[model samples]
Target: MRFLVFSLAFCAIFTYCLANRPKHDVSEDNYLELVREIEDEIAKENELKHEAREKDNLEQAREENGQEKAIVGNYDEPPYTDKEISYLQLAREVSDQYMEEIRRENEESENVGARTASDSLRAFSHPSRRTQMLAEENERQDAELETLQMLASGENLRMRNLPDLTAKTVQDDPTCNTKLDCEGKNLNLVDGKEFRTITGTCNNKLNYTWGMAGAQHRRLLPNAYNDGKWKIRKLSVTSRPRKKVFLPSARKISNVVHKTTKPKPENEDSISLGLFYFMQFIDHDLAKTAEGHVRKKKICCKTPTKATKFCLPIVVEESDDQFDKDDCMESRRSFVVYRCNDNVRNQINEITSYLDASMVYGSSEEEEDTLRTKKAGLLKMSTEDFLPISERATSLPCNATDVSTCYEAGDTRANVHPGLLTYHTVFAREHNRIAKELRKVNSGWSDERLYQETRKIVGGEIQHIVYTHMLPVLIQDSVLDQHGVTKEYDYKDSVDASMTAAFSMVYRYHNLMPHKLNLGRLKGDGVETFEQFNQESVFQKPSFVTRDNYDGINEVTLGMIQSQCPYVNRFMNAAARDLLFLDKNGNSFDLVALNIMRGRDWGTPSYTAYRALCGLGIATTWNDLTNTTDQEDIDKMKEVYADVQDVDLWTGVMTEKKLAGSISGATQSCLLAMHFANIKHGDRFWYEGSFSEDQLEEIKKITLARVLCDTLEDITLMRENVFRTNSDWKRCSDIEGKIDFSKWQE
Candidate 1:
């Protein structure tokens, strides 16, 4: 009897200890098993919820059939959809099931210690202490499980889960109709004349300190200057109001000059195809659309009889008749008007001189979110078969469910042309490559840190390329020196970098576009076979890069350098003239005409006025233009305009002979030089300024050639001067010319 009691007591104490062992102290295998069991239980609960939903549906159906259901008093709302009702039912069932499981588990854990420990064992082994410890352990395990569930649902992550709280909230003014009208309320306007300068209390509402840069008030209220309030000066012969000059129609001018002038393919003196693309990239970085019209309907032009308030067609005049008799559409569709923020008299009311890599990284919080992947702070790239590809293909995203438009980094016009798209792709890839390198170097750095650092480096590269390679070629060294655009770094508050109307008009160098895109591969022996593609065919198409195992981009890069650009003249390529967009019914619109019209619409003074402003000789007669332009070009202007004073800036600039050792004419070169000089002087974060000595050194090493070699795939050989067409192709492995990114490493 004694032996039997001793053995029973020993067995009891051993079992009690085993039962009371801490539930949190789980072995690896057992912990995994527990997780699997919990997952299985959750799955079973979902199944039960689904079944409960089905049963509820059946019961409701039976009740409806058995008796006439009475409607709730005073409520006439329609019943919820079957899917919606079912989802709600399932959610309720799941919640109830989860609660019941938790309660049952708690009860079982609490009773385990009590059931295992007998009265004699409890006295000797301290049952209350063991039970309390077990309860505490169970609570911890429950808390941990809950945390795991939350983590799995991705609720704990910072940028990934939370809404962007830093987004700007813009309030629209109800009284204002147009952007110009909003500014007019505060300004004193002369009868039949537009407000030339911001006077009075108008300066108080518009903040020039941190707001957009404008042309007029260069010091205190720069953003308010020329807020679409300037009027085109009238010609000496015309009696039209200054605000309402009866200028020639954009379409009519296009038909006369652009349609008549055939494509004159004249290669630039020494500039490369890379330079052309880089210019376009820079254009997009600085400018955006002024608040203007939008197209109401796609078919608005087809049926003029059904014209509404939204339909403002570009009426083609009889004198400029270049279109075929049968195919000549009477009504060319116009853009629909969507005014900018009239309250502030600015587009988005943001400073334009920041040059904060808005072209690559994006400008707004929403845009930033769309561009970011939230994984290592890398910008999102369009993928092919789950493999990372280029910047999300322009028109469509990979996972787009509908025909809605897709997103791109920085600018919307980045994918408007093939060359622009190629550059965007290279820089995007560069950002990712740098981010990956940074991650490797600083193992503990987060995605945000890596992305920002990479962005800074890319911005620096752009600044270096523009200032070093492009500016020298565009604006001659003499003009740069005259304008004080020296390499010396200084931030001047008085210098306004706002894009002037003349600057914007002159920058439209569509005449430089080649008719055909030369696509070819550069061989090891520095020879290549060019495959010519019509420029219109690849306008917004990015799929061309994926051809030949993604080697087409390199081929095109080489081809652009090899192909010659057309001379800057009235003539345009057939691609730009004949097929700008399919919706326009085979190039119904003309780009040159649009440029002239846009300049006038923006209320910019004529070429003579701009010449006077720049301290050059103002031409009063057609013969006076001989000093600035060729004799033949002057005769062409006489036929178009009544007097030299009426000549549009765009027409005059394009016709002028290219300045000696410069890509552009005198007026264009001057405007570009002044604008760029101001952009450098005014910008607080100009790459050369406020950088560490080491950072500045690294930035100076960056060049367009290095950027191309580093970012482009399989670009083994590259010319030293990427901005110029040359036969000196050197291997990318040549360390003499290559930029060393080691200094950027943490």
Candidate 2:
């Protein structure tokens, strides 16, 4: 009994030892190695199978041709058959399953000893895991095999193809040249009709390509709709059966879309009053559509009494009846018609689209000739001591109706406001400063060379300020990323950087205009002396800047920074209801009505189309607009339009909620992003292009604040954030943040 019991104990101990031993000693590396071996065996078997099939085909062909068949040579049989290949693939799958099981087991026993051999082996032998692994492995192997076969056979691999990044050339793209090559024999004529005569002589003709000092030529994009031929591209993605159906009456739109309300201050402070004028300066540089000479009679305004003819009467709602009954004009007293460029004879076309600072330098040769001094590349200036003197100076011609009222140089719209005149003066001074510095650096440089170089530098400065300082504040970071607006040094010629209709209309931020302008001076005692002027009084008035020995100009600059801009949504009563540029009788037109009409005149698509274009959800119903607009604004839209699709682009954008971290709504933000992106990416001579490393470095140092300090004579200190006023104003000299111009010394 003792012997039997001892034997039983020994047997039990041996069984325990076997059960605890490591199962097969398998690991991830070992499994991987086994898989590789199986893969090799399968490949070899597949090759042998291919050869066998080919041999059979050859034999069959020979028999059909009645040719004698050669005896087969004695060769070693393939190491693996088709069945063996299948088995090998199965083995690889099993190895994969074992690896997965081992991984799971290792995780389960991480803090403990190794699991029993029986349990591990059982998990590895799981039939379901083996079947799923085999299927996945087969699919992967088939794909890889197909790819390899395609490569070996020299077939085009679709997976290897990528987007072409080469610049498109004129040969391939019809819209690739600078010159407007007309189909007629005479360069000056278009199709039997005389082309618009070039106004200036060719002696100091501007270089159409390089924008040299004497170059007065402005070239349109080769494929631009208005490029000599009247081929205006339709802006709408889909055509409406009745074009007028898509277009709501401008007066009706103004009454609904831009109804005047109490003024609301913007949530954020205006960094600098200069920004308002700066935008205008930039706009002048970009676009100046010719005005129509013929006055077309149209009724734009309608009162409760009757619809009367002005340029077009603005329809007023009862809520917007702030105008005195006696004071209300039946028509727009001052009607300057917009010039037409298309066959329709109603479409307006911009004269200049390049960022060449044409606003300050002058758009045409004749204008440039009048502005240039022909000595030291200096611009003509007013002799009056009190006036600001620079290129694009506000100086009256001797034959002017009122010599006291100054005529603006460069852009025709330069005399739009005194604030814009201030910006023009500052930038013009900056150009002379740069020119003088460059002359000192290179004494042998001619007036032409000096002028062109100075212009280049000024353009660079403008581009830098816009991209670095202004854009970040205007657009959110996410929107910038979404639109790919980040700096790209390489030039992309394929990009058509022309301004779009939507961008032109949405950018009209007239609501930001304050009702009054403040003119103030920083006194010797550190106390500010301020005097307020009405918006109408400052229009086309540069005399205010010259009055009191130019103290008013200094006071105006100080006042601009001191004042806060009103909210963008609430148009001041002055701008929305009673904009200036009136006749002698003091009859005025509604600015909002003009903006809405301009959008229609430009043929911009309705709001819903733009929403779809911008990747936003289309508002089929008022309820669909909830994501982008306020509930009250959506309700207002519903009251105005029967269908959401009929809502105008400007109206929809204006009513939408401001995007997070941005002042404009999503649609406007998207449009701005698209426009700015085109400007940056499309321009070959972009400021951030592959110019000399040193030149680019110098250009980067030019900031708006630094430019202000360099140009402003009396102002010593200024705030770092020019857009907003500081609690305590700092002197320009005291501001440590000025850009170092010394790096530009060459």
Candidate 3:
């Protein structure tokens, strides 16, 4: 009691001294920091009093019960040590101080209003000035890719003016750029024409292959590793001791963080199942990383005693809810890229990184040649106007009788699920439809001209759908405008269009899938059920998509539009949580576990690194994760992870509370915004830039609803926003923004 009084007296004296000190003579940071320490001491004193009262209550309860037993059902957090209490105090101070900083800064904005929480979107207020700064920054900094290449060649490099970049190019025997590019073999010269190459090269004039197919994915932060080199980050990166902390087993983290006993709730946003799968489709189009040298199958589990470096199987402990005690989940590391003698490992992205419909048309010339018939500029169609049946021997993976159901597209992942196949089918049909329309106006055009023009149009329509229809559903419109993703972009070659590893980690949004895969049609509030399949059965099986005389396509299309997505939460659906990728022996891998392991396998940084990068401050303790989610989630995360920094990006971001007016959390939203913004501003062939104002308008008119209308023979009527369930249904003819191809006349 006396110590408390003396502490109060000390605080009074300290406050007086600081207040009387002139503002010009004192540092705001130092002042706030000292004030924070005083507040922390007060908080500690209060906690002591609270604990004394709780002890008294516990003693009274024990006396009344006639027992001296310890308290049960106490799920309270562990008592903090002195150091921990200090950290907790800093966390408490951060909230009010951070908010004040943002509010004060926001008031100085040119075109902004008052808002609480965060004033992060203020960067958009002066975009021209911002862009100039970015351009100037790029000019001053050497390209990271160049730096990596130079380090690979064992050359000493100063920050500025290194030797010719071409001297350090990888020893590729083929597929090199001509004299036009800064790097690449002087072998191929691709012209910048009306159409883009199947290979995502020549997108940048000064540096060809910046967004090229088969290039290495860019790293947003330096890769974290156990050995601080090629080894996966199986341990915490924290140099300071936090009570013998290490990264827990991925499976353990999964079972705890994603432990949901309640029935998984539907998305409150009412995002349709179609949009959920469309996210996967976008992933397939953008990044198709090459399969690892080692396969992710029975090899790792079978050879656990002598497992190679390439085989990092996920551990399943005795306490596992699903797997047997002895079983381990089969896993494989991504094929390591050849980055010379550098210890820092990197992975390869085998396809184009652009949001181009590489999923539909193929990213490489070889894949394009296989997909195209070179006849009338139309992609081949099978009987009943379905996607062409695959001729490749390995394409059909189902039972022999199900061969009839197998079909092909530019991306082989079309065989993975009905949603991807449905999307592939629609785009293939849309391509043929557009080619036929082009032939109507310009009969003199050759197959090459027709194919190129149609391809360009289809690609433009895709970019429009992703930016206009899909992104708005995922991110806020205000956010879109803030990030300049929705703005008219002038192509900037200075920007590196390569995707970051962080972006890839964010794309694993598998929790959005509902456990029961509904395949049916909806008429008003009623339903016309066709078939229902579980998650495991539909994978690698095409029969589900080709059933009922090919009515399955239409049924599944409607199923996607009508069914609601599972809400974005920590809960992994039972099917994904336990039944993912079942093998003949009844053993299966957990998707949630795989997501965590994969982030580590790729050497991606922990959640705190990305948070700091995205302007979400680095957390020193789990309590410091106040900006992330509710305390319940933080408690769950803290239970799994030993230290806050040990949490993987996939697990951390997935558990975050959704940002206001957005489906994703703040850090993820920022990273995604950065990605789309780069692709839009950096792409030489971004639709708005390549097309005339009239042609661009026609492109903008193409929405996802219009795409469905053109492709789905059975979809006579669909909701205006095909991605939204609450939208009004209308006949195909009544849908607005139908494409006008007359503007395409050259």
Candidate 4:
């Protein structure tokens, strides 16, 4: 049993030893073979390392040689160092330094090579030079076009002296002085013709170009038109005022904005005050003249009524004799005519007798002949009644040089033919009545209120001008029924010498019409009453049209709103919801309101809107921008906002710049005219001066009100811009010249 147990223990120990021993054992021969394989790999690795080092060392040696040569070449000497030295030792030292440099250079070279390859790859992937060149060309062309437009729109006068003047010219020559010579002179003369008053119109071929384009003729605005009535000429060369204000440079004038002020009953009545000056107009004729030594003239008639009463100085003596006041002629019954509120009539009577006796004597026939001759020059009358005087000198004395000079001293009234003056007087009377009615509504108003009211009236006048005359000119009579272009002008006159067109060619384009592109919101059902307009409610109404329909809709209809409303700022964003929003592609899309703060890449009409919002103050500063990822840019914008506020504070700074004087009357009138003219003609006039008759009719489709609004707005802008630019020029100056210093009647 002991022997069997020993066997089991021995077996267990043997099994444990076998389990712990190596699974595969090598003999000396196998181990030697493995060792040889390991040795071979180590040798190969060392060989590679040695080869790399040798190559590196060779490169270092070569680099060291090059540097030594460069150092010698650049500095003319080797740098000295403290060391035990020999030629080989020096070479080895230089080689060590160069080896490090070579290593660095290799790294740098690799880096540069990689960068060049990367750049090459990128260049290959990018768009071609042709595309870039084309883009550049397009940009350049766009800039040029913009510059041209800006130049054309600028305030500069193209005077008659310029070759481009489109007005008809009739040069006055001395040859056409005889009655038979008058046959060739252009005039509206007929034997025994009853004189009728007519307004003078500018007759220019350019003005009638539309007729040539198979469009209707355009007519000049009436003499009563504000722009027409007031020439707004540049101050005479001698009348130029000092542009700099007399006030201190830093001085600021406090502004007072009157909300509402009523005229007091105790205040002097404007009418009564105005009538005080009526004393200058009493009739001196029909007075009793005593016989012999300078007769003292007696009063013609007693004052009829308090309203019609006027103070007149009794003539104490005649020109031949000085004497005391005369009380005679009390029994002389006076035939009198008292026209109610006849300012001009009284004025004429006050001065006419002086002309009859004192200024010129026995010269009525001569005066009539001279006036007839002058009238012939105006092309409105004939010289048949006027005797030709090739060389004439006036011998009339008593401070009178001739009929014309005497007439001028009487305020151009006497020189103007009786027929023309009669018409002018009638027109003036009507205009004054209209002005008085306007004053009733405008009285006690602030400057802003007055400006707005005046603009509205002006707008109405412009509408009448375009619709009544200009439209007919643009669309010929044949097409008048259809309101389109046609090749016919029924109203033939000598003025229509160029038969190619019966209308003003300028109006024969879409840009010339007032209704072509209606941009105002006051069209259709949107027309608001005065009250609604005054309130904010007008803008609050739903927009019937939007920018998306802009191309298709009549832009003229929107002119009022365009003139009044903020075009592209907050209002645009607010209205964008209703309007069809367009992208650069003209594709309709939803506007991201936040993008306004982000700035637009495309045109946003931002400047126009800025002008409108200037009075509204709807914009916010950087502090107002919240949750913006870019805070730095926001901070900068805050600075810009402060500058903008400063600009608001310095409203008159522009006047200081003399920007007002820089703009001529022609510019102001042209701007106003173009605003309407563009609407009537369409887009052609926007960029070019040429237009077709079809374009003109398209313009006629525009509304009259919009044209007026645009015109008025342009005038207002011109005035404001001029004032701003020449704010510095505003200074204390005596209101002399033709301006009456007397307070204007309400």
Candidate 5:
């Protein structure tokens, strides 16, 4: 029963198992088959889900694309800040997309081990491919960030260095017609504008600045204002009278002379009297005009004799029938000789009689006596009278002498007869006397001493030139405003006036002499230190600072020296005297003032506008904290720190090196100066920090006596071989030699 029953049960059980379990293996095969079926179903479901997802992704992509297009279309109208935010958001999205792509690729690489592999699986596993893409992405983002940083920095710099802030501000003068007032509704400050909303004030004197008013005052207006259409309007102004001011005790001496004086004529034998020759080369216009005049006047000249003939001729007629030829000739000769007064006739008659009586066929006592008497009579007469006049009476046809000293000749033309040379000589003498007088008024120097001193160095010719040319430059610059011809503080006009004065003075004196007036030539050999050869040269000896000071303030001094001049950097051949003023020993005091004044407008100590006021000697009031900064005694210090935060040059004081007190005080002074004078940095003086370190060093070296005083040729020869040679070569060949990088993939 067990066998039979077990067989039946076994059969049943086996059949049941066969029906329930996998038939082929009932173990690994069956389980695998089931697993494969389930996998197939799951795959089918997954495929459907993937298709749905793909459709969703396409819709999302389309929506995203539409949004991107809209954003791009409206990009021009969007606010810059909004645009920046949008770009930042796009960058974040891109980063997120890249990170997600990396994760997906990693996941795919892991999944590839369990599934049938494809070429894409290998590509997804390649670390170098992802690395390259990531590197490119990171590089692009880095560049964008760097560009943004640069833009931000540039904007901040632009704000910090407003190019025309001073120009925009109204001059703080009550007399200014464009001055703003907070009275009534004349100004926007009183009208409660969007730019300004002053609710109340004590007679408008203490009104609050708001909106545009505050923005402008604070220099918060962006660079966009550079292109705006705006007009300045005046609400109120003062009618105050202006006062005249004179140059300080420190008068800047000019090299050119200013005035002239004419000397009185003397007799032929006067010891002081001498012939003066003045030469002039006419300008194109004048020469052409003179030439035209000559042509119009029908003036003619012949060679050899080269005699000039005037249009109005003096004629002589001869008639042969009137008298015998010899007799007529004798009568004509007699007429020529005796056509004079009784005194001249008697003198001639006696002179001829003595000569005739003195002549003898042979030696005799009576003839010798007669000859001795005639010689004695000739000796009593003036040398001029005894001598025969030559045909070429005038050395220069145009030259004129004292009429009383010359036998009157009819050859001199009336128009051009008073020679240009003579006129100029007279002009020069007169000019020198006037210039000397002008100099004495303020210089406290004696005229004769000046004349003697001047004479020893430059001849009377050059002295005359100085008076005619150089003196007017100083006078017109110094005194013209007092004479109601101009005004003080008008810099362009002032510079123009000064230069014109200089030019005119140069022109007049230059015309007074025969030699050409070359300013460059005048500066030949430069100025020397010793007084032994102290002549009309412009350069003075160098006033060098102590070696200790030189080392300590090396950078500052160099910058100051170079900044004052423009040519010291670009042109190596600039004259030594021109490095500063006429003097070689640069004016240290003026240099310091210039340094301070230059800072009034730019960089760390920009006080250009301030110095303009101070330069004008205007009284000003500022906050006590600021004003007290200048009180420090800095005579001992050499280094002047131009800190970014400070507005004044702070002398390096051992006790207060950290404090910026001097800066504040100096800034106040400069600001006050600017408000008063309306001076610009480039106009009044050179600012430090304008030059690079290398340029400054080069310029400061100019102060060295040996460097500047040396000839340019010598300097050129010495420095001819010195240069910066770049020797390093780039690895361009290796980089170019690399094969196509993608070839490895093939």
Candidate 6:
């Protein structure tokens, strides 16, 4: 009854606030501020309602059982007292059925008749994967609690050394540490959520933070560390009389495997550069590993002993032609933390682990707030219909220039390259385009409601494109069919949606990048190449995407479609292999080297281990690798790795021959299958169920070509399948089944 009373009181308060809204016309920005203020009040009121309900439940339990019970009153509020923290800890250890009962009881107030998947779990006797994961979590927690307590007292981990937590954190504070721990992110999840959260929380009905930002990446196998502690993999085993694996340098592996002299083979499908750039764009959408403090090049490369604990510099042999003797590539370890006091270390995924176009909408609520105009529910953009220009007073982050300054967007890495930034600009336009269309029909909708609804539609379109248009190119149709990755209506609460660390390593398609990026126009007679750039010159350089540049965002966008991807073999172009992310000093990092070393940093199991896991026949010796890997590649692997089991996951993946009708190999195909399959099956609010049948059909009809046509005004022509170079070309006006937002009207 207290819950109902509090809710009624909240309605009265909210109504009064709305009634007191400005009678006089205000500036657009001021109007947005007022709307946000009301939204904040609503969130506060909802939080209070939860606290009151919990308090009521406690009192009721105490009276009936003749005993005291703890309650988390003002649950969502900060500065959680010890008693409240204890209650939260206690809640974690409870049985799944009990948690479901709590959930059912909580929802019974608003949804008495609705049945959830958990309702069926109540009748089951067998343990599930969720239960097993929880058990593993409990075990890890028991072990890691000691380490956390010790670390709390230890005078170590300076602000620079801390893993992904705020610099403001006083390391000794238990409350602060609790918030940083995995599964401890404070998120508000309620039943019947209309749209996915910005941070990817609440995707799982049972586990609110399963794939949320700051959550540890899911692992295919146990981390392989030398000490079984916090060390990068070096030794062959962590057991008795450990033999040093003496792993080959990541650079050496790169030189041997990717620095190919043989003639490069073109993509069999004649895939366009647009699809290659999309590979990068969507990858940014899915996962981003948290980076540690910026590396101090002098400390990391010159003085090893004085370096911060986070520095894990890659050694460049003295014989290397690129630099002086004893030079090392400056690097920092990824930010990691325990699983809420668990003993294991896990790298954090800094973005939402869904195909929800988080790159267009920032991953966190705080980040998202900066990207919105809050007027007519549109995202912030420049007057030129380009992304908003960066100004915290013109301080540059990447290779951005003052004239063609880096534009701010949902993701910071939007400025990494011209092609990637083009996608960001196009998607931001799409959001506003959808918002204005929605407003035309339903002007009565509040700013908040309109924004969320538009966000929902955009997210739906993104998922449809990824599952339908993108995955087929990356994997075989038969593999997708076998895994049911493309199927809708497979939402299972039991499935965990967390991204695997292996997928990050396997999806590095650096080999396909062309050495040069060309801007051209396809006119009546033939194509005219107007401008060109060495791909390295534009690395982290935002100028190429700006209107001032010769080949601006539009030219880059069109050129990418017209330009051909050089090849799809294991060999990387000179730009990617030797000049990627070329710093101001002209020093660049090797993509293949970075990928191989990251596997060590992440502690992903060896290539053979993953092969076994994927049901690809394992190689006990070099001779056994023939069926899975080519003979020539097996010879290369034998040269680099000390043992068959000791090969890096990335190296193994590259050498394996591509499957028939797919760009990926058998193991790569399996991992992608699992990743996409779980992503679809695990999401409680997946696009299919979230939209009406009519709306879903409209979304399905939408294509990347159609989106490009609709957004890029200058792009008069496009291929039906942007991924295929030989696909039939069409005029923008002739593109069929373009999404009509009017069908979305109430």
- Best candidate (score: TM-score): 6
The sequence of per-residue lDDT tens digits that candidate 3 reaches over residues 409-512 is 77756766788788888998999999999888878777888888888899999998898788887776766787789878878899888877888889777878
Compared with the true structure, what per-residue lDDT tens digits does model 6 show for residues 1-746? 12222222233333445475433333433533433344354445445555556466445533332232333233453433233322222222222223333345434432211212111111111122222233333322322232222222332322121121111111111111432322323333222235677887666646766777656688878888655645777655322455444678888878777786543556767788888899998888887774443211224556555654446777876445454556566665665555444456667677778778788988888668878988889998875788887653122234433534567776667776888888988899999888999998888877777788888888888888888888888898988988778665678888887878998889888877887887867676334557888887766566676654433877787788877786666688778776666654556677788788888888888998999888877778888777777888888777777788888988888888888887888888888898889888888778888888788888889888888888878777877788887777788888875877778776
Candidate 6, backbone clash total: 0
Model 2's TM-score against the true structure: 0.62
lDDT of 1 by residue, 66-103 (tens): 22242221145443233333322322233334334445
Candidate 5 lDDT over residue span 363-399, tens digit each: 1222122212221111111121211121322211212
Query: What digit string (tens of lDDT, one per residue) describes model 4 on residues 1-746?
Result: 12222222233223332464333333433432432333343334445454445444434533432222222122443421111111122223222333343345434433111122112212111221222232223222222222222222232312111111111111111112222221222222223221110111111212322112111112222111112221111121122256522211110111111001221121111111111111111111101111101001212223212111111112212221111223111111111111122211100011111101111111122332342222111101212111121121111110112222212111122111221122222222222233344455546644333322222232233233333433332223322333221222222232322211001111111111111112333333232212112111111111211123321112222232232221101111211221112222222211111122111111112211232222322223333222211344334333322322221111111111111212111111122233233233321111112213443333333332223223222112111111011211111121111111112233
Give candidate 3 misplaced runs (Cα > 4 Å).
1-192, 238-245, 295-298, 393-401, 522-527
Each model's lDDT comes to: 0.52, 0.51, 0.67, 0.22, 0.21, 0.65
Error (Å) of candidate 5 at residue 545 is: 55
Superior by TM-score: candidate 5 or candidate 6:
6
Model 4 TM-score, 2 decimals: 0.14
Backbone clashes (count) for model 5: 35
Cα displacement (angstroms), candidate 2, residue 544, comes to: 1.9
Backbone collisions counted per model: 7, 30, 0, 64, 35, 0
Overall local distance difference test of candidate 6: 0.65
For each candidate, give its TM-score against the true structure: 0.64, 0.62, 0.74, 0.14, 0.14, 0.74
| Candidate 4 displacement at residue 465 in angstroms | 6.0
Best by lDDT: 3
The TM-score, computed over Cα atoms with residue i paired to residue i, of candidate 6 is 0.74
Question: What ranking of all candidate models by lDDT puts the best one first?
Answer: 3, 6, 1, 2, 4, 5
Question: Cα RMSD (Å) between model 4 and the true structure?
Answer: 41.7
